[model samples]
Target chain A: MGKRPDRRESFVVRLYVADREATAVRAIANLEALCREFLPSGCELEIIDILREPQRGLDDSIMVTPTLIKLAPPPVRRIFGDLSNRGRLLDALGLTGLELSPPRP
Target chain B: MARKNQKEREPRLAKAQTGIDGVDEITGGGLPRGRTTLLAGPAGSGKTVLALQTLVNGARRFDEPGIFVAFEEGFQQVAANAASFGWEIPSLVQKRGRRSPRLAFVDGRLSPGAVQAGTFDLSGLLAAVEFRAKEIGAKRIVFDGIDVLLVMLNDPRVERGEMCRIHDLLERAGVAGVVTMSTAGLEPPGSFMLSLSDCIIQLTHRLAERASIRGFRVVKYRGSAFIANEFPFAIASQGIEVADFGTRPKYRVFTERVSSGIPRLDHMLAGGYFRGSTVLVTGMPGTAKTTLAGAFVAAACARGERALYISLDEQPAEILRNLASVSIRLERYVRSRLLEIYADHPQETSPEEQFVRMRQRIRAHRPSTLVIDPISAAIRMGGQSTVLGVAERLLAMAKSEGITTLWTSLYQGSEEAMEATPLHVSTVADTWIHLSYRAGRGERNRSLTVIKSRGTGHSHQVRELILDDRGVDLADVYTVGGEALMGTARWEGERAEVATQRDVEAEEARKRRELEILAAEIRAQTEGLERRRESLAAEMRLLDQSITLRERNESRRQQEVRARRGGEPASRAGRRKGRSAPTED
Candidate 1:
């Protein structure tokens, strides 16, 4: 897949999950690959397991699992529960309108 | 759970006691222990408060630690709300960011903005809940507003699966659980969570008579028996309390009889109603129902005992002023705190809340007598069944407190309010006094009849309730031609009776005087005749003397002219000649 870089290159994302859940793991992996591809200048990522820091999850108003937040964007955005849809993730991160090419086999 | 019996086939399921008022009784001793109870209601129907109150009661009374997982509201908000109820939740909750041994609040809310990219389970929430539950050794737990979370689960199958998992977890934990959901327009949503619930309690809050009424109905309870009727419930400052007094009756039989203020009424009731008895006075408007209640209060107060009078339609001042017209002076008693008149509009609060307030007043005042004047207003403000529930509970409360209670209802339709009272008060009331207006003789008269009085024989005849400046009393019943004559008719009949007696006495006196006069005249005439007879006798004597003298004079003159009688003989001969002429005539 080919990704077009945006003028705002730097990206910061926070991922919240609950104890290595299958959906959470999949969301984490998907987010990592997408961030590496989109944020050519590198992305700062912090992962928190809500099971351990549940109070923080509550404090931050994070109830759903596998929730990812885009921090670097001027407008904060949240995508929750298996963020495996790359196109929707891009839209949530304010990275929409990026051209997509066919995936290599 | 009920008592164990020797012949019982199976033991009932153990129950966890929710210390809320009237709740445990209605639920047959709270929700089944270690089982899930689904509370279905519309939003703002008191589902959250009910569920939370149960948790607090469980933690406070049963010494059972509990956990609350809120999905719609935050735990802090829940605690803040509970503060108004004075539940002491803040102190009992987690302290210093550590799990509280008494109770724990777990956040189960999901971000409203959170978008589901793929399928996700509620493992995180489950883990947190399980951890908190164990941390507090919770015996009870609540999943409040689980509907919000369920809606986020996005798929019915996934939601069902998650619900099953939650149910299984609670079962494994062996903690009594409560799950609240906002149903769609009062209809229970056919959800798997509902099916998994062992007990289903439906809470309803709707507008009736322009006031909100809250109630609870046990829709279903598996493997147990529960009250199926929809009983009114109120969420007051203290908490949710159901108005259910059917199971436990505090019936007390007192041998002492209390006067009904009006002595004649007491006599009609065969020495008044029993102490701690419930008396119902039913009548139409203006039949002096409140007057009777006031008389009772005055009587109780006069006995140096406290009484509570509740008027649904009148103010205390109005009642006092009106009762004063009948010489029922309650001012002094009120000043002395012997009589308390609590008046209010019946539509101001819900019937359940009214019951709670009434109970509070009874407890605070400790009155020996209680009166609810014209419960019809309350019945009209509330529905028949709703107010009936409150009325029954209120009567039970009065009975348990061992206070004489009187309730008045405005009966409509016929003069025959004697058959029964509205709201089935005839059955429960020990004395049923039906006050009716008999419109006859071009005027209305108030008559009170005792339809029934338990344990005593009451007057079968109706007595007219007479209220005058002197006081309230029952007039002496008078029947004329099989109809009771009252008011002016009675006065006229009595007046006519006295006038007839007076006329008869006058006639008798006149007849006696006339006979005496006639006898006197006859005596006078007899006296005159006697006088005349005496005169005649004298004259006859004289005549006889004259005749004898004349004969003797003649013989003497003939025999011997020489007798000296010759001179008397001449005068006697003249008198004898006159007498002879009179005798010949």
Candidate 2:
């Protein structure tokens, strides 16, 4: 057994996409923009292609695409669908203070 | 010396590698640090490519060293195939030095031969893999086509027995490895290797219509969870790529409704459908379900959004021509790549394979809307569980991808309903359209009604449908005295009788009016005749009186003139007699 070290805490905003192509490309672009605007510099933004690496898609029990999983905060949260709604997305991701206004209908 | 010291400072766990890009994000990092995964497939199913790609991906994408153990294909062939895909494996091996290169290939056949013609049992292969692993300090390893090793052994039981031994050897060596198995005749029963591996990925290829469809399903991935559906995959010059199997991204529900192309249907669905919502169209045989679905595809294509139509029942050419007869030109859209038609019989392929193929095509095309004409046939291709599971996964996948999906179902009787209903489909669907033929008065009338539509108000009344060369049209409901006819046949006989009775009454009334006018003319003429007769009688009387008076006068004269010879005759006589008698008078 290896010696135990000090416990380290990290914040990661993971986006589980169906594949690495058109929709995912656009989603990655949007998420990158969002992260640039809202997330702290030290926080990590991880994008996982569920189709390329299906085990990951399964580990999270993700049945849908473009699902964003916020792992940093306790009680892991998930927001499904397109991440176009900035306010709801920010709220779901626990970035409420940095939330943007709701998009027009 | 400084670089070596820096490398020594790096953590050991950091040395572990994942073969696929963007994958480390989900496994909490990657596949367990030092575990074996078996990549299994039948002949020519791209098993070798997958293994080689994994090795190369690990080397280039993750900075992890890897080793390829070739048992079937020669080193040159493997290198050449990889080179065609733009992978310069030989150069990478040369650049990193034979000692610390990122990749190396070990010939398994030579390993046994090297051991005094009595090679070190399973230890030889393990040692070579580990030797190469340590030489380049490789973190990931792949055994390209392990079936050669299995075939080298004469005893079948011994071959099966060696699986655990090989697995243990790899585990002890701390090298994460993937073994390729040629499924050939070695299916579940024959391949005892399946039970020994930590992860099992089965690749399949089905030759259909001169087009080959390739797919893979993870039968088991030990500790890690994976999307259970057999995801569709493709092998091109670049490598294997899986189709997107994620949930549709949630978009704000657009309030606008797009026409279904069939005007009567549009009215039935309450003026069209909301964008980004799924609609289910179901019906019996010859109910124009395909026509309705085709119209939807045409409408979507006309709107300039790429539309995909997957037909599990008919041929693409026939369906296209069928639509063209109704004035829907799909060929133009097809030429523009805005419309794609995929047609195949369900019996010709497995449902899982079919789903994968569909996903691959969808991913490639990225159509705005997808239509599965008669999803029932697609589901029936697989067993009940497989069909349900595939549908569940597919619906979830489509919804997540933000692609509006329309699935058609055949309304079979209760006995077969369980398999055909796609019961779970309703849960994911935003709208449901039920089409049925109402039989009445010896004629069958087609009707469309919305059984349910979420987030939008829709009509509940069953609307009559008209499909012709001019396209579908909604006619004013046939209503008599405020009651709409249930069906054309049901109302025909009674309506005809009522119309005939009305015509008879009109004819009788017209004849009576003519008789009245004739009777009035007859009465007027009779009155005039009576008056004339009276006038004639009066005239005659006057003449008679005059005659009588004249006669009297003649008689008086005659008395005087023999007297006056009775007036006239008597007057003539009287004149003569009076002339004779006048002298005497």
RMSD of each candidate relative to the true structure: 32.6, 37.3
DockQ for candidate 1, please give it: 0.27
> Which portions of model 2 show Cα errors greater than 4 Å?
A1-105, B1-29, B34-53, B59-65, B71-103, B110-137, B144-175, B179-256, B267-271, B412-420, B441-443, B476-585
Best-matching candidate per DockQ: 1
Model 2 lDDT per residue over B1-585, tens place: 988766664334332444432233322244444566777778898888877887788888877778887878767888999998789988777754334677887765432211111111344345445555666777777777778777665456757655676677567767777788887644643367877777777778875443456666767766565555665555654665553334344555667787888776676666787776788877777777777788888889888998989888888898888888777778999999898898867776666556667776788889878888877876555455556556766666676666777888887554235334555376667887776776655666776767778876777666666667877655434444644455554346355666668877999999999999999999999999999999999999999999999898777765664434444575577457656755654
Residue-wise C-alpha lDDT for candidate 1, range B377-463, written one tens digit per residue: 887577776788788889988998899999998877665544544574678788888888776789889887887888888877778
Query: What is the CAPRI rating of model 1's predicted complex?
Result: acceptable
Candidate 2 accuracy as lDDT: 0.67
Cα interface RMSD of each candidate: 2.3, 23.8
> How much DockQ does model 2 earn?
0.02
The C-alpha TM-scores of every prediction are 0.77, 0.53
